[model samples]
Target: MENRNPDRATESCLVLMLKSPGRSKQRLAASIGPLAAIAAEHLCYCAFEDMAAWPGPVCFAPADEHDGGWLAARISPADAVVPQRGRNLGERINHVNRTLRMRGFERQIFIGIDCPELDERYLEQAADALGDHDVVLGPALDGGVVLMGVRHEWPDLGELAWSSTRLMADLEQFCNALGWRMARLAPLADVDTFEDLDALKRVVGEDARPARRALGAWLANDGHRPETQP
Candidate 1:
């Protein structure tokens, strides 16, 4: 895709992707304690900082903006949207992408708030790839993706199947069917379960002070009464 606007380089697109901090997963934190909200806040902060200097505008879509307006202020001018009702994650993402494109952004990238390990270098690479590719993806070690970017008008948001373990593969197949060249960055892991938290601890070590503190506090008081399954 040719740079339709030279000034766009100074204005790369970004979306601070998030869902409401309290919901199904909210109860998990209750079991663990107050650290749940803190953990969620930290992840959002990490994601915001990671893509802070990208080439386009940064927008946020939270499930609710009551607390979001304040949180969004920490990042940039943000727009909140209820995650698409009656839809899966893929549909919601595609909806956000399409909304942004209609607003005149030449390129768009959506990132999840769960991946604190995500960094700017990877985002920069994705921006650079946008110069030639229709889509760029940062695949996660798990069966999902942490980031997705598009340089042109997005296709039908409903065309792609979402939230399955095959999400990444399904997206690739969609691009192939459309004859779009796709690019990928190195895979990274996202924090999801207790095991994921343990891995993050190992990777960051004592230096993982903040996340560790938050995780510890959460585990200490979370009252979910997590069950062990055989």
Candidate 2:
């Protein structure tokens, strides 16, 4: 049987599955370099820490052995285990979900580290959605998802085709076929391309203090250039 936290098991848990800071996607180097990675890591850390203060358990679903130690040192030791199988994203996420289910977590919300705009309000909304639906999704502008929450252990890994433009559509169809009610939160943009970075500047504002400071510091010293193409 899964180990259930009497105080939090029934409440929703947030699972942040991430590649350790140093091992993030290298394609970002053309636009933001290590700063992009740093920003992503900071976003994940902040979300995890913020959600930890919620009325539920917050877990880190680190991607590898190296990440295990690094993440454990930064987050709670009682968090979920790292996934052990699959080279593909779909299989890996399914593995994590299965592991969490085995550990007696009834509801789970999983997210990536790419969206800095993701905050506590989104987390709360996801949890609330679980009260009426079997799944909740926060779709990204890139036709992928930034957040997914499930009320139970769902093994429909086929629904989520990782890194594809059809991912959201596939998931929606899969949920319909499974007779699972699905809910959606507002869509957010993921920072993956130069266009994405440009959009961020617009949304956050070019003159915004922290935004400007972060971009200036990154551009000044970080050896990164704007991508000519996505």
Name the candidate that leads on lDDT: 2
Writing each residue's lDDT as its tens digit, candidate 2 over 33-84 gives 6555665564455456555656786667778888777777876556555554
Question: Judged by lDDT against the true structure, how good is candidate 2?
Answer: 0.69
* Candidate 1 local lDDT, 108-134, one digit each (tens): 777877676665566767777777788
The C-alpha lDDT values of all candidates are 0.63, 0.69
RMSD of 1: 5.7
| Weakest ten-residue segment in model 2 by summed lDDT | 1-10
Worst ten-residue run, lDDT, model 1?
221-230
